[model samples]
Target chain A: MSHPTSTTNKTLAHPLNAWYVAGWDYELTRKPLARTIANRPLALFRTEDGRPVALADACWHRLAPLSMGKTLGRDEIQCPYHGITYNSAGRCTSMPAQETINPSATVPSFPIVDRYRFAWVWLGDPEKADPALIPDMHQMSSPEWAGDGETIYAPCNYQLVLDNLMDLTHEEFVHASSIGQEELSASDFKVTHDDRTVTVARWMFDIEAPPFWLKNMRDKFPGFEGRVDRWQIIHFEAPSTIRIDVGVAKAGTGAADGDRSQGVNGYVMNTISPETDKTCHYFWAFMRNYCLDSQLITTQLRNGVHGVFGEDEAMLKAQQEAIDANPDYEFYSLNIDAGGMWVRRLIERMLEAEGRLAATQEPQPARVGA
Target chain B: MAANSSTVWQRGRVVELRDVARDIRRVVIEPESPVRAAPGTHVDIAVVVNGEQDVRSYSVVESDDDGTRLALSVFRTPTSRGGSVFMHGLGEGAEVELTQPLQNFPLRVGAARYIILAGGIGVTAVLGMARVLARLGADYRFVYAGRSREAMAYLDELIDEHGDRIEVHVDAEGTPLDVPSLVGGLGRDTELYMCGPIRLMDAVRRAWQDFGLDLPNLRYETFGNSGWFDPEEFVVRIPRLGLETVVPKDRSMLEALEAAGADPMFDCRKGECGLCEVEVLELTGDIDHRDVFYSQRQQEASAKMCCCVSRVVTPAATGSRERKPVISIELS
Candidate 1:
């Protein structure tokens, strides 16, 4: 193991206490769902609901990806290339032809967990993974009036959004519509950084002032007259989960269902996951808690968020392209860039803490293909 | 037991089945698993007329895979479902089991020019050797003799598959066999593998002696089964374990050992199956060699298969009084 000099080389392979957003809960089912973390392809599907299972993707027989295979009625995955099937724990189930055989014919599988509506994969030291240590999501469970939400996939690194979300000032300049116009008062928001998580809070008012969708009760919504009454709370738990608050009406009141998008309305909560350093998966769900017709709310929320995600796609793609073109380029900063600096520093510190993992995870010599 | 009892595993459909003769069928066991019996190597085949393990061995004639299909020609007998019967009854698209490759008889190695004599289905195993000779561009002559031209299972097949490499001889002219001419002036590195009924093989076997011909080799595969093992009741002492047990004729030496509380490990069961091997502390009987294990010298010492095939000699049966102390037969 060599000493890691910087945080840029850190990956999900490292064993860290930092939070990692595995995937949407729905991604796991009785079937096998394959995902790659830190370039290591893995199959992670729940044999049953409410579980996050992971296993090495390749079969021992022919090195075929079990992820590409399917499940038989025995809760075993049949290798698509051959008829060899393996069970959940990765044991060879049937040889299809032999009545009896030598006893060394099985594949390998991994340990897993299902928690907080997200398929949380243990992207760290599996032996040390204590389910109690996973981040608790009390916010999602509270019976608060919230809007319905949707999920979207982004073709950019998840860290980009972490950086994007942590740096609160990107909204005013990048997003000219909706809540992006909220101005950050010079010193209104206080910032706090902890060893495992970070939080940022500030106040902004007159958010429904212009180009805003709420036209019916624009005057009726609270804090519509003040220039800075909107209190924005931002939280960035590492790996890739960011939460924020955009002060708005309680769910269900005509405000939550206000005809805002084009002519429709909804609320959104976005989650960003790194499909890879070059591609990211985004999931945003609409929290339509108070909506009278929940099904209709779910549909509207999916469509509206999908459209906005389409817009985000165009911008992120361009951003990734520009980054690729200018890989060696650097950026400057000023005092107003406090949010970006804080998040970056937090990442650097956390990565530095995982020095052991990074050191031992050096790449080995490439195997010659037979 | 039913004739079709030895087959253990198979999943491919039969591509074609031809009753090339009254007692022979050319079965094409295609792309299921690979059948790897060499030119003279044999395999145990199980044909399930009902549900039982009645087995018989057959020599593999060919092995090839072209991505499209594989083919095997077997001669099934109406009286014998084990090999000939199974193959004869197998229809196109019918499933069949070809046990793991068994090398009951390996090809005589290091022979350059050779004479291969076949009688009936005995030619099946020798076909592979002929094919190998052709592939390697080696010099070899084949004399394939059977009842008749059309009645021969692969008579035309050998002609179509290997041209100019074989000489077809049938017993249709009401003439005696020409053993002298066939065995004359054979090359130095040449050998003879005569496979057929006992009489033909014995005749071929004696031709070398009669002609006083010094040939490279002469080998044969006989229609061997049933009495390959004889059952008898007796007692054997193990000097190694210092114990004596009842030896039952119906039970194999391996079964006798375990029945009397001795431990053993094994694999295949046929005498050809090399599992229940035991060391001979001492013995007395003509070591009838049916097993595929051990060498000539070992069998000469009366040391061999105690599991399926072996006999014991008593003190009065043998003249020796002062036997080797602590005489025993331990696990092999």
Candidate 2:
């Protein structure tokens, strides 16, 4: 195994102004919850009115983690070490031993908005916190859809997870027994990109259904076994949100031509937030539009997805260790890395723009619309 | 006499205009100066229509904390009487006069919980309330009902920002919202705030009353254009002014009176204000009292009506040859 220092030096820096899924919304309640984003410790909690707020975990006075402190009243957080209280905006409101709060007694507060059952925090300029920039995860919230998911902490860089999601050919090798099928590996795929999004789509026609799909679809369609058309459409938003729409239908059902109802459709929402250079927070939700009220299907799909992602996590962590051991080795890109590469390019462009703007010391142009 | 001091007129530039939903355009205005806007507040904007300054009130959908910019989602209804048409016609960079943010439906803080009921374009009014509640960490449920998801303004953004706290009911999806069940399911201490079409508000109000909920807990704002009775041609007799005019189905009594050169005192044409109230001398029909300004007792008395929105609906007499529901009223 390589020394820890070798891995520490290889940690990647993420863009500061982009939104990152900090954690599930239900995780941050009355109690102060602590999480790390881009290597910065953050404390998340709700005020008296139930609004979620995110602030730097460190107290400005004694450098104690605010998450260790108890929330006072509805909007104030009292440092556990010194009993100093800070308001929801991170301004020091009171000190037990001081008559007045110091002029510089404040902590950085990040803009947070709850969406798709996740609290997204903007770690950049508050003025630039445009809620519209948040990726549209409508399937998770719409009543037309239903599913369950679990958040797993992976001891690997988020980029590795992105690569894993962008390329599903590994499924045939990694998850052979569950969701994997030979058709996925044999099928050709295409990658497309716009100004802010990248999409990788694959279709396998007249192929046998995978074991997982066959198990889930048997009761819904109990006819004799037959060939089916399968598809996997992966959409990567700027930064770290990926949604994979995968399903299967009877052959020649026109499932690829915007008519998804012809097939059993399901969505895999994978949102990654970098906790540090070597570790990330992985938030995943699996949902389906059909059988929405069926708890059996929900549980079965949840477990299936959880197990599938566990396989990816094991591979990604092992890959990270390998990269750490061979620090001088440069990685080569493959045909399937197009989507992940596009995502990285977009992040680089955003970081470069932010750096240029900072160097010029120019204020962001006033935004007229959301 | 001093000019009307109640309205603090301000100039604003239309910086952005884009469709948020079918027939619903999101108008973003940058005020000449900053203006503070409380939750559930609205602003009155004035526009030129047919060479006349026509003013209409629009709920503030979103605003910066400092109120440097204001966003109003305007829905151009099929029956819009020039105001929404003019607003929809405006392009980016258009300048208009607007009143400072006015709080008619101010959100009551400190409630144990909140229930926001919105219908169609009425989502614009309740949006800020939801934002404030989310920020305060207050417990609230937002229910938005519309004919269809595509026709609902700010549906995507609201769902994105609110998560599961929002419940959307689209009639086209056959998932019509049951207002009674929703109202009855509310906690005893939950406060309800609603804004929408007249019919929806009326239905909710009826359901709320049936549930025997506290009257104080129920709050609502109307667009002033909705009425219980289908609008029909009516004859208005003004004895004091010695003028008679035919109020068309599309026109209000106030508009007809004003067009006939009679200056009638009026404000808030949406029936919330009694400024345009006129004593009914001889009502030859039953009155359709639509304004929120009067109590049930006053409406039952049938002594006066808000000429701006409330109208007379004549009932057919038993065994009468002419069974038409024509409304005829003599104004005092």
Candidate 3:
């Protein structure tokens, strides 16, 4: 018999208290862009002075979408249905029907911060919104790091994408031709977590570089060829952000000991924002410490990561479909799920703090015979 | 969804066992796999109580960064439902069934300032969290209270590690905790995380409300075994299951039902989760609710009870002395 209860559901509710990236800094311009985060629709735009702002997408008058309307003076947006105009704070400044605006004729203006080349919006209580709580994605804006990235409209829950990045063993099966190597599953990893972060670090010694790493190595050192030491250190910050530090060094270098002078290092920056229960807006970038001035290398690496992540997109879509089909079945986890489990636990805590947790228990590791 | 992998009960060996306080035992368990435990992590042990296997949860006191080893201290409650008694009897090399480290009371990072309060045995649940905040160089204070100095576990160790950041209060020393002043003095940005006896938690809760502090800023973990009234033997009759059993003072209603072959759904087993709640069709005695899951209004209604930790307490002189307190429930 199948039993469906709140405690066994696979889909998790999002935490509104945390910050989720709405779009790239360039995407939010004078024109308003409609985006949803944590199930709340927001109209994102920039002020004339180049400061980002996020307001409720629904107009206070007649509930018309404000994003469909055009910008008026400075930072004001006009309602598409009527001529009502709202300022950056979502307060109605002009009403065509009357001289005096209604005191309650105001939409919610969320607190937004433009940092690390992304516009992050807080969809919860404005009083508790703190910019310091934004996940650290320093590589995106650092002058020492150079790269570019794109957005993936993933057809899966944000947690699925988080699980995919927390464990890289699946790369051996999903992206075998690009970054996969048999040594990945064979290597032992150490998983550590604090209140807000979970880290999984793995290193492979004296192994042949995967095709993706080999190509990147040759870009920095034209004729680089040899067995190399590879490392994948994944750091996950609460809600939905993961930054992976990856690279390969010459076999005998002391890369594992914090000396990576003879290595080519790159960081895969990812922050996913939930648009709804079954969809997410995935913003990612591929940044590298080396080749800071090489536009050719930057474009190549971006495209390379794009191709690699496409495979994950397909797999995650299929996984979500399977989950929907078998709503009575719960996911089973293995040793590889240690990091992902911590990520889920952290998100669960956030949801509980927001009074949204409904007894949903993420699957634990499979039971072994006693 | 069906219950699949909420927990993986595995066999673990009691590698070390020692007395940490006057009535507390510190146990070290070595599982087959490494368990990386963060702050507020706990483990569920399948202990044999009343000759039947039952699950009990205890907060982790300490753990290695690599999770190769885990330590927990259990208070030898004189009024326990036998979980603590079974734990106190465990010797080195004993095999026990245990779940991996599970966290429900996670410490939210990035708070402006933190104040961690522990009352008596509640210290076990908040010790790791205080340590993490201290290590991060964050602004925090640790307030620990016990009935006496000798009964406090890890008192010297905590003082040595945290130094001036630690504050000690002993009721026997006439330094009882002042919840009203503590709650009233909290700053607007301070987050208070506490774990302790129900009365202590209740006092803090009432004081926090009176001061009109942010509700979300006050987080706590319930000592599941502690409640408002002393446990008494009662009769639980489930009509649909056609089961009737006597819940002894040393056992919980959920344990009694499971022992009678009536499987009941439960998670956390600490009464925080409402999965094990059953509708109360009728009652012949007052319900001693020990769960934080329900609100004051809901508990006052007496329409439902959490089977994991709640029970009925009959008046001493009501009806015949031989007649036990009975509660009829509807279980789906």
- Which candidate gets the maximum TM-score versus the true structure? 3
lDDT of 1 at B4: 24
lDDT-sorted candidate list, best first: 3, 2, 1
Q: Residue by residue across A49-162, what tens digits does model 3's lDDT show?
A: 777888889998689999998788766888899878887767676777332344336787887888999999888755356687899999999999999999999999988999
Candidate 1: lDDT over CA atoms?
0.57
Which candidate tops lDDT? 3
DockQ of each: 0.01, 0.01, 0.01
**Model 3 residue B276 distance off true place after TM-score fit, in angstroms:** 54
lDDT of 1 by residue, B105-157 (tens): 54532234577788777777787777766664556778888777766777777
Q: Report the poorest 10 consecutive residues by lDDT, candidate 2 chain B.
A: B319-328
Q: Give the alpha carbon lDDT tens digit for every residue of A286-364 in model 2.
A: 9888887889999989998888888888898999999778655555667776777777667656666566313322222
Q: Model 3 off-target regions past 4 Å?
A: A1-9, A359-370, B1-332
What docking tier does model 2 reach? incorrect
For model 1, state the Cα shift of residue B97 in Å: 53
Q: What is the per-residue lDDT of model 1 for residues A112-156, given as tens digits with 9 covering 90 to 100?
A: 555556665555543334455555453444455444455556666
Q: Candidate 2 at residue A56, lDDT?
A: 94
